[model samples]
Target: MQLGKAVRLERIMNRNNGRTIIVPLDHGVTVGPIYGLVDLRETVNQVAEGGANAMLMHKGIPRCSHRRHGRDIGLIIHLSASTSLSPHPNAKTLVGSVTDAIKLGADAVSVHINLGDETESRMLADLGAICSEANEWGMPVLAMMYARGPKIENEYDPDVVAHCARVGVELGADIVKVNYTGDPKSFVRVVEGCCVPVVIAGGPKLENELDLVRMVHDSVQAGGAGLSVGRNIFQHPNPVKIVAALHKVVHEDWDIDAAMELL
Candidate 1:
């Protein structure tokens, strides 16, 4: 890698103790102002102060997020989306380009891919093309891989989830964001199979805080570099405390019980 690219990667790795704690505020494009993220800046500030290393958002949010926050959280630009109200919500379309992301001063750019969906082929082509472009720009790509098709009833199936993660790396993603397989042993397979660093998605918001901490702990134990959580942190009664707890799990390698105590 070139000096600039290597520096950027180092910055990302350094932020979360070689692991990552990225709080995604890109929800507005998909599900406008979902309960907790109504005020994006305030929520981002709280998490950033609580030790979050990075914040992922669509173009709009980053346009306003402060550059000199408590600890210079890295910014990731999400380039794909399809709102829930859209006619084909699952068919993600490109909304921003890698060049646009760089122009926005993004440290990295992310794309969402729904494997096995009707529009899978189109999205895959886009992903490959975007990866190529990102390579030339020396920009990192974070692929959010999820299985969603008629055949995929349970995304948690070990084999299916593993395949989804592998495909993301194969498509040239620098970092693959995937769902946790409920157990460290199974999730370890997914992480081992991917060529690039693996990170776990927060998925939907959970009702309990401990459940979220346990999931992060398990994923990290399974070799995941870190987490890309959204609703789980933002929707919590105390997002700052929640992030601090998660940081302990992802960065400090604390167990669920220990991490929960921080909350």
Candidate 2:
């Protein structure tokens, strides 16, 4: 890795633990300003104050959420998006460039790609182009790869998840985010298949907070680098406390029971 990229990764990942907790707040473009997203600065502050390593958002969000004074949190600009209303919502297109993220002072840039979508080729091409540009600038790239297509019967199947993660690494992503395969045993294969760090997405909101924390714990046990969860963390009744608990679990190796005490 380039010195510049290494330096930037340090901002979003715990250098001591090689783990991270990134809260994604870029859902407004995909689902329209949903709850937890309307008050950008406050939400960002709350998450950051709770010790989230980074917050991922669309290019324009920093103008609203970037704090002049507060606990610092790394920024990751999401470069691709697709509205939920779109018939082809699974197909993500690049709406921001690596140059745009750099100008906005981002620590990293992320792109979403649905591996089995009809427009998979286009999204892959976009990812390749973005990776090339990001490499030139020494900007880290996180690829959110999912198996969301007609052929994919179970997106959470370990093999499917592993393949998605490997695609991200093969395409040059610094980190790959995929759905957890439901258990440490299955998820371990997902992590081992990818050369780069692998992280799990929160998926839909879970029924209880413990489930969320347990998922993080299990993923980490499976060798996942950490998490890039969105709704579960930010949309929780107490985002700050949950994040702190996650921090303990991911970075401090706290037991799930101990981490849950923060909630």
Candidate 3:
């Protein structure tokens, strides 16, 4: 890896603990301007102050996000997109390139790949090609792998989730973001199968803050590095407090009830 890329990766991965806490704010492309992300800058500020190690956003966001707030939070540029309004939402196309992400001053780059979809083969091909290119550029690639389609029985299926995680690493992702299998024992298989570091996605908004906290705690206990939560943190009444509580679970290893008290 190049000196700059190596330094960036090292900075994102906590040296004291090999895990990471990445707050993803690229939802605008998929779900439009949701409640929590109505003001992207404010949301970014909240997560940054709450001790999130890194924040992932699409190209436009980093360009306008508060530079001071970003000083502490490593920025990752997401390169793929599939909007809710689109007829085929599962088809994630590459909207940006790694070179463009570098020019945007991104510390890393990410792509979303939907497994079991009709377009699965094409997306996987794109992921593989991008991973190879990123390797040459010395840039780290985060793969957001999700199971969704007619063939997929359940997103939480242990076998299916494990295969999704493995595919990301096999395709060359430095870090894999996937959905947690409801149980810790089942989720462990997913983590164990992946060669790269694995993190769980927040999925959708939860009914309550405690539910979200418990999910994060469970994922961590199951051997996930951390979380790439979006709506759960940003949509909460107090994003800063929510992120702080999540930090306790992810970085401090606190239980759900204990972390909820901090909220």
Candidate 4:
């Protein structure tokens, strides 16, 4: 671990708690500016004000969302993307580079890898290439690893999730993000499999806010470093409320019951 990378990762994850709440705004590239993201700056401001550790976005967005007034938030540039319209949307292809992220003043860079996808080999190869580039610059890399594709029966299976997370660590990711295995006990295997920090992803919008908070709480209990949840936090009518609640759960050691009060 280089000093440069360590220092940069501190900006993304709280050094004391070793946890982070990263809101991904890169959804626009994949899903077309759905819901809350229509105003990326405002959404970023709201979450930043609520104490989000970082915000992840594609290259063009950092410049637009970087503002002068709100609390400073760390930025992670997403390097891969594929639109919903694509025939194989799960096959994420690199749309930017580590150099591009650094030029955009990103504290970290992330790439998506769908393990069981038809193009897994390409995505994995690209991940290795980008990681090498990131190493040269001493930039931290977060791998968005998922068990998605034809063969996967239940992506949430703990074994499958753990394998996805391990792939990130094996490939040199500083941090790994994968889906939670419904409960804390099951997700523990995921954290144990990867020596690096592991964060859980918010798959889709949940029906209730309590469910979101509970899921985050359980993941934390299972030793998750934090969350890279997007739509669940951003799409809520009160984005700040949700991010604030999540901040408490991830950083302040608040219990599920206590955390739910924020919402």
Candidate 5:
């Protein structure tokens, strides 16, 4: 690995455990400035204070959330975007570049790809190009891959999830994020199939906190790197406590019970 990329990866992943707890705050582009995201500084600070490994946001947000003091958090500049109001919301387009991320002082850059979307080929092309450009600068690329299309019956199906992860690996992503396959046994297959580290995505807000932590715990047990959760963490009544709990679960290998204590 390039020293530059390795150094930056350490900022977003626990050096000892090789795991991470990333909070995505880029939803403003898709859904607008929703509840948990209206106050960028506070949200960024709360997650950082809670020991989140990194915070992912759109390219334009660093100015709003950059911290001068307190715990430092890794920044991942999201390069792709699509508005929910769009008829083709799943078709993400590259709205930023690796050079832009470097200018923003991002630790990494990420792109979203919906495998089954009508524009799947275009998104893949964008991901391939971004990976090539990022490699030149020794920047890490995180690919958020999902199986969302008309032919898909269940996105969480183990086979489907594994395919999404493998596509990212084949395309040169350093880290791949996909939906969890419901249980550790099935999820393990997804992890085993991918050479690169696989992280689970928090699809939506869970009604029960236990469900959320258990999912993270199980994924780790199945050899997942960690999680890149958005609404589940940021939308919680207390984002700090939830992020802290997740930090323990991911980096410390805490069981659901012990991690839940933080909440």
Candidate 6:
């Protein structure tokens, strides 16, 4: 790996713990500007101040939301989008290029791929293209791979999630984001199958903060790298506290009881 890219990846994943707490703030493209994101600059600052390893956002966010002063966090530009209201919501399309992301001072670029979607081929092609382009610039690529489609009986099936993670590695992703398969035993398959680092998605916003904290604990126990969470952390009334709680789980390997105390 190029020293520049290696150094940037270190910003996202802690060198000591080999894990990360990436708060994704790019939902506006798919779900409109929801709570916790109306004021992008403030939201970014809140998570960074809480010791989040990185923030994944769309191209425009860096220009509009990056704080002039505060804790500096790694920035990853998400290149794919598909609205929930779309007829084929799982069919993600690329809206930004790696070169565009690099110009925006991105440390890395990410792409979303729905493995069983009707447009699965298109998304895979986009992943390959982005990886190729990102490699030339020595930028890391993070693939958010999911099994979502009419044919998929269970997106969180352990076998299916393993496939999702493996695809990210097969396609040259430096890191892979996937859904947790409920427990450590099942989720371990995903972590083992992929050679690259595997992080769990926060999934839907849970009913309580403890549920989110427990999920992070479970994923870490399963040997997963960490989390790429969004609403559960950012949309919470106490965003900074929530991220601090999760940081304990990911970096310190705290059990639920210890992590929950941070909340």
CA lDDT, every model vs. true structure? 0.85, 0.94, 0.85, 0.92, 0.94, 0.91
lDDT, candidate 4, 44-146, per-residue tens:
9899988999999999987678787869999999999999999999999999998898888889999999999999999999999998999999999999999
RMSD of each: 1.5, 0.6, 1.5, 0.8, 0.7, 0.9
Between candidates 1 and 2, name the one with more favorable lDDT.
Answer: 2
How accurate locally is residue 158 in candidate 1, as Cα lDDT from 0 to 100?
A: 81
Considering summed lDDT, which 10 consecutive residues are worst modelled in model 1?
9-18
Off by over 4 Å in 4: none
Can you rank all candidates by TM-score, best first? Answer: 2, 5, 4, 6, 1, 3
lDDT of 2 by residue, 173-235 (tens): 999999989999999888888988899999998999999999999999989999999999889
Where's the lowest-lDDT run of ten residues in candidate 6? 253-262
Error of 6 at 35 (Å): 0.7
True lDDT of residue 248, candidate 1? 79
RMSD of 2: 0.6
Write one digit per residue (lDDT tens) for candidate 1, span 81-188.
999998788899999999888888888889999998999999999999999999888888899999987778898888888898888889888888988899999998
**After superposing candidate 1, which stretches have Cα over 4 Å from the reference?**
15-17
Clashing pairs in 3: none
Q: After superposition, how far is residue 137 of candidate 4 from its true place, in Å?
A: 0.7
Candidate 6 lDDT, 7-85, residue by residue in tens: 8899889989789999999899899999988999999989998889999999987888977899999999999998989
